[model samples]
Target chain A: MTSATKTLELLSFFSEQHPEIGLSQFCKLTSRDKATTYRHLQSLEIVGFIEKNPLTKKYRMGPAVLPLAQIRERTVPRKSAAKASVEQLADATGETAHVSVLSGTTLYSLVAVESPKHSTRAIVDLKTLPLHATASGICTLAYGPDILTQTAKQNLERFTAKTQTTEQGLDAAIQRVKETGFSHSKGSIEEDIYGLSAPLFDQSGTIAGAVSVASVATRFNADAERTIKHQLILASRQISHNWGGSIPNPIEACWSKTLAET
Target chain B: MTSATKTLELLSFFSEQHPEIGLSQFCKLTSRDKATTYRHLQSLEIVGFIEKNPLTKKYRMGPAVLPLAQIRERTVPRKSAAKASVEQLADATGETAHVSVLSGTTLYSLVAVESPKHSTRAIVDLKTLPLHATASGICTLAYGPDILTQTAKQNLERFTAKTQTTEQGLDAAIQRVKETGFSHSKGSIEEDIYGLSAPLFDQSGTIAGAVSVASVATRFNADAERTIKHQLILASRQISHNWGGSIPNPIEACWSKTLAET
Candidate 1:
C-alpha cells in the first residue's frame, strides 16, 4: 500500500465508541512502528484532519471533515433526499430504517433512523456493511454492479451462525434476493436482528443504494414482514425519485409479482 | 509539504461552485506538475476521498467523507448541539444566524440558518471565515486564544471597503469586541451586510466557537442591533451550555453591563 493510503487508513480506526486515540493506542491498532505511526498522526494533525484533545492529548476527528462532507452532500445529495423517506419507513414499520449507498465496491451506511415505538429495536451501527452478511449488502449484490459479488467472495467474515461464509452460500442468498425483489436476512450479522431491504436508484439509472428496515427477530412475523416490505417499497421509490432515478422496469415487475403472490 | 498533506490539500479545491475537477483542472488549480497532481489524485481516489464521475471522468468527493463527518459529529457533538440555538437566533432576529468553530487557526463555518422573513438575507456561504473581516473571526480574536490574533494579522485579506486591512485597524476592532462582549462588522465581507457575534465555549473551559447574526445593512437600525445583540447573547449562552461550557464570568459581566447601559 502507498504511504498516503496507510496515513488515510489511520482515520478509519475512529468511531462513535472510540472517538479518541493516543500515540500508544495508534501503534497497537495499526501494528506499525511507533515512530511511523506518530509521523502519520502528525501529518494528519497538520492538515486539521485530526486534533489533539487538550486534556488527554489524544487525537479526535477535526473540523476539516465537515466541509468535505458538505461538498459530498451537495454533489451527491443522497443522504438529505433519503432522510425523510427513511424516517417515514421507520415510523411505519416500528423498526430501525437505514439507507446504504454503494460507492466504489463499498456499501456505506449513509444514514439510519430508529423507531421510538419499540423499547428495544435493531440498530444499524456498522459504518460499512459486509456484503455477505447484510440484507442491504445482499440486495446490492443482486441489483448493483456485478463486481460486488466478486468482492464479496474474497472476504466473507462470518459474524454469526447464519452469516454466509462461502461463495456458494452467498450466491444462494443473492439468488433469493433476486427472486423476491427484496433482500431478507435472519440472524445474519446479529443473532436477534431481522433485516429487509429494497434497492434504490440514482440519476445514473443504476442501483445507487438500498433502503432497509431492521427489526428485532422476536417481532418478525408474516404480518410484520408484509408491512415492512410494503413500507420498504414505498421508501425505495421515494428515495430513488428524490435521487433523480426511477425503479427499473424488471424490479418493478418482480415486486408486483411477489406482492401479488404474498 | 509531505505527499499526504498535498494529497489532502486537493480536497479543498472542491466547493459548491466547483464540485468536480478534472486532472488538468486540478493541476491548474494547485499550480503543481501534472505527474505530482495525478499521483495525489490517485492516492485520494484509492481511499475513496474522491471519485471520478463515470461519464465525465471528473473527480468529486466520495462517500468516505460522510462516515468521517459522522464520527466528528458524534465526537464533538457541536453541530447538533448548536443547531437549535442558531435556528432560534435567526427566528428572533429575522436574519441569517450561523455558528463557526475554531480549528487550528481556521474558523470553519459549522452551520447556518437563514430567516425567511427577509427577502435580501445575508448568506453565509464561505466554508472558512476570514479572521480580519468577519464578526465571528473578530469575536474569536478578542475572546479566544491569543495566537488567533497573530494569525489574523498575518493574512488580512481585504474583502470590502470596511474590512480591516491594517494591524492597527484590526486591533481597534478587537478592542471594541473585548469591551462590549460582542463583535460587529459593517460591510466588511459584503457590501451591505451587518454582522454581530458572541463567543461560544466548550467543555474545555475555553472559547470553542461563535454564534453570529448577519443582517441586511439598510434594515440594521439601533432597535435591530439591540435585538440582535440580546438574541446573540441568548444563543451563545445556550450553545455554550449545550457544549458543556458556560460563559466566563468576565464576559457575562461585560454583556450585562453593556446591555444595561444601552
Candidate 2:
C-alpha cells in the first residue's frame, strides 16, 4: 500500500467496541512499532479524523467526519432512503436489520435497527463485515464487483467454526448465495447468531450493498428463515427502488424458485 | 503539513454546493500540480474516503465516512442530542436553525433545520462556518477555548461587507457576545441573512458548540429578534442539558439581563 493509504487504513481499527484507542493500544492492534503508529495517529489527528480524549489521552473519532458524511448523504442520500425499509424489516423479522454499502472491496455498515420484541438479539456492531464470514458479505460477493471474490480469498479470518476459512469453502458458500438469491450464514461471525441478506442495487445498476436480518441462532428455525427471506425481498426492492435501481430478473427468479422449493 | 495531512485535507473541499470535484478542478482549487493532486485523490479513493462517479468521473465522498460518522455519533451523539432542539428553535423562530461543534480551530456544521413557515429563508449550506464571520463562530470565539480568538483573528476572511475583517472589529463582536450571552451577525456571512446564536456546552463544562438561527434580513426586526433570542436560550439550554451540560451562571445572568433589558 502507498504510505498515505496505509496512514488512512489505521482508522478501520476503530469500532463501536473499541471506540477509543491509546497510542500503545493502536500500535499493538496494527502490529506496527510505536513510532510509525504514533505518526499515523498524528496524521489522522491533524485532519480531525481522530481526537485525543482529555482525561484518558486515548483517541476517538473526531468531529471532522460529520460534514463528510452529511455531504455524502446529500450527494447520494443512501441512509435516509434505506432507513425506513431497514426499520420495517427489523420489525417484520423480529431481528436486527441493517444496510451495508459496498465501497471498493469493503462493505461498510450504513444503518442498523434492532427489534425490541426479543429479549435476546444479534447486535450489528461491526463497522465492516467480513466478506467470507457474514451473510451480507456473501451477498455482495455473489452480486458485487468481480474482484471482491479475490479480495475475500486473500483474507479468510475465521470468526467461528462455521466461517469459511478455505477458498473452496468460501466459493461454495458464494455459489449457494447466487442460486438462492439470498445469503445465509449460520454462526459464522458469532456463535449464536444467524444472518440472512439480500443484495441492494443503486442507480449504476450494480450491486451497491445488502439488506440483512441478523437473528438469535436459537430462534432461527425454518419458519423464521422463511419469514426473514420474505421480508428481505420486500426490503431489497423497496430500498433498491428508492436508490433508483431495480431487482434484476434473474435474482427475482432465484428468489421465486428458492421460496417455492423451500 | 505532513504528506498524509495534506492528502486528507483534500476532503475538506467537498460541500453541498460543490459535492463532486474533478482532478483538474482540485488542482485549480488547491493550486497544486496535476500529479500530486491525482496521487492524493488516489490515496483518498483507495481508502474509500472519496470515490469516482462512474458517469462523471468526478470524485465525491465515499461510503467510508458513514461508519466513522456513526461511530462518532455513537461516542458523542452530538447530532441526535442537538437535532430536536434545533428543530424546535426553527419552528419557534420561523428561521433556519443550526448547530455547530468546535473541532480544533474549525467550527463544523453539525445539524441544521429550515422552517417551512417562510418561503424565502437563509440556507445554512456551509460545511464549516467561518470563525471570523458567522454568529456561531463569534459565539465560539466569545466562550470557547481562549486560543480560538487568535485563530479567528489570523484568518479574518471577509464574507460580506459587515464581516469583521480586523482584530479590533472581531474582538468587539466577541465582547458583545460575552456580555449579552448571544452572538448576532447581520449580513456578515451572507448579504441578506441575519444570524443570532448562543453557545452550547457539553459535559466538559466548556463551550462545545453553538446553536444559531439564521433568518432573512428583511424579516429580522426587533420583535422577530426578541422571539429568536427567547427561543435560542431555551434551545441552547435544552441541547446543553441533553449533552450533559448546563448554562453557566455568568452566561445565564447575561441572558437574563439581555432579555429583561430588551
Candidate 3:
C-alpha cells in the first residue's frame, strides 16, 4: 500500500476502543515498516490530525479533529435508544421525548419523537438551543463548563420571554438541576413549550448528555409533575445504562468563567 | 504555521456550503505563495487527502477520505448522533431503537437503546445483525450490488424463523427494498420481534445508513403498522434531509453505481 494510504489508515486505528496507540502497535496495525510509519506519523503530527504523548509515545487524535468532527457530525446528523423504556415513557406520559447534547452552548439535538396520536410531526432542528433556556443545557451546566464554553463562544442569545443571558443566571439554573436530578425549563426557547431534562452519563463518569420530555405547557402542569418526573428519571437511567455512562459528580462551572478569560 | 498546517487550513474552506476549490483561489484562501501552495498541495495530494482534477485542476477531498469520515462519523467510538437519537427514540416508543451501517452482509450497529418496560432487552449486546433478519439491514438492502457486494461478503447467517441465509434470498430481499420504500422482517434477527426499516440516503445520493424501531409481537401489531409507517417515513426524511439527500430516483443510484464502478 502507498505511504499515503498508511497515513490515512492511521486515523482509523484510533477509535472509541483505542483512542491512543503506541508507534510500534500503530505500525503493526497499518502493516507499515517502522521507519515508514514514523515518517508518516510525523507528517500526520505536523498536520494536526494527531499528537504524541511525550511519556508513552502513544498517539491520539488532536484538538484540530474535534471541530471538524463536531461540525460534520452535526450537519451530517440523525437517533434511538433503550427502546422499551422510551416506549414506556411515552405510554405513561403521552408526551414527545428527546435526548440532546451541548455543542458550543446550543442544545445540539440528538434524537426525539412524539406519540402518533398527539404527534404534530415536530421539527427539532438540530441547531443550537441556547444554554440559558433548555433542560438539556441545565444538565450540561450541572456537569461542567465544556457546554458553557461552547455556548459562550457563540455569545448567549435571548430568543423569548423566559430567556436568561447572564452567567449568574445560568449558574442558578444548573444548581436546580443538581438538586432535583432533573431540570424544568419553561418556554425559554419557544413560547408555550415546557421541558423536563435529566442527565445521561457515560462509562467514564461524565455527563454524556441530557434527555428531556417536552410538552406544550398546558399539558405539563403541576398535576402531571410527579408522573413526568418519574418517567424522565427512569428514561435517563435506561439510556445511561444503554450508553454505559457513569453518573459524574456535580460540576463547579465557576471554572468555566476562568476558562472563558483564557 | 507550517505548509502542512496551511494545507489543512485550506480544507476548512470546504464546508457543506463550499466543497471544492480552484488553484489560485485555494492559495488565496491559505495566504501562501503560488509556488509554495503548489508544493504543499502536491504533498497532500501524494498522501490522498485531496485530489486535483486533471481537467479542471480544482481540488476536492479524495477517495481515502470518504471511508475515514464514514468510520469516524459512523463507526468511531465517540458518543455520536446515533447514540443521542436512539436514547430519544427509545423513550418515545417504549421499544428498542437502533442505527446501523451495512457491513459485509450484516449491519454493524453504531448505536442502540433498550426498552424500559420490557423485562428483557433483547438487544443488550450490540454488534453485527444478519442482513435478512434486521430492519436496518433489510433497509440497507435497497442499495445496488456495489454496496450489497460489500455486504454479501459476510455470506449471511440465519438467526431465527425468518432469517435469509442464501444468496438468492438476500438478492430477493434487496429487490424487495427496491420495490417498496420500506422493508420488514419478522422473527428474524431475534425471535418474536417484528422489525421495520427504511433506507437513509446521503447528499451525494448514496445509502449512508439506516435507523430502525423494533418490538415484540404484541407491541408491533396492526396498530403499529400505521404509526410505524408514518414515523419511519418522517424519521428517515429528517435524517436524509440532514445528509442533504433528496428523494432518490432509482435510476440515479444506478447511474452513480455504473460511474463509480467504472
lDDT of 2: 0.88
Question: Which regions in candidate 3 have their CA more than 4 angstroms from the true location?
Answer: A1-262, B1-79, B103-106, B117-121, B144-156, B202-205, B237-262
* Candidate 3, B126-185: lDDT as tens digits: 677665567777777666345674555466666876777777786777776676666777
Candidate 3 residue lDDT tens string, A1-262: 4344456567767655676688899778877799878877777777557766554578866434433433333332223334445556666777777777544445676766675646442335656655667777776777756546455535657878787677777777777676666777888778877878777764344666777777777666665666777677678766665443434443223223322433
Please provide, for model 1 over B97-201, each residue's C-alpha lDDT reduced to its tens digit, 9 standing for 90 to 100.
999999989999999999999898999999999988999999999987778899789889989888889999999999999999999999999989999999998
How much is the lDDT of residue A146 in candidate 3?
Answer: 57
Model 3 chain A worst lDDT run, 10 consecutive residues: A250-259
Return the candidate ranking by DockQ, descending.
1, 2, 3
Query: Per-model C-alpha lDDT, please?
Result: 0.88, 0.88, 0.62
Give a tens-digit lDDT track for model 1, residues A128-241. 999889999999999877788998899989899988898888888999888889999899999999999999986456788899999999989999989999999999987886
Q: What's model 3's lDDT at A92?
A: 74
Clashing pairs in 2: none
Per-residue lDDT of A1-262 in model 2, one digit per residue for the tens?
7778988888888777788889998887778899988998999988778877766788888767766776776787888768878999999998999999999998999999999999899899999999999999999999976799999999999898888899999889989999999999999999999999999986456899999999998988999999999999999998886564678999999999999987
Off by over 4 Å in 1: A79-262, B79-262
Per-residue C-alpha lDDT of model 2 across residues B1-262, encoded as one tens digit per residue: 7778889989999877898999999999989899999999999988778878766889988767876766776776778668878989999998999999998999999999999998999998899999989999999999977788887787888778888898988889989998999999999999999999999986456798999999999988999989999999999997886564668999999999999988
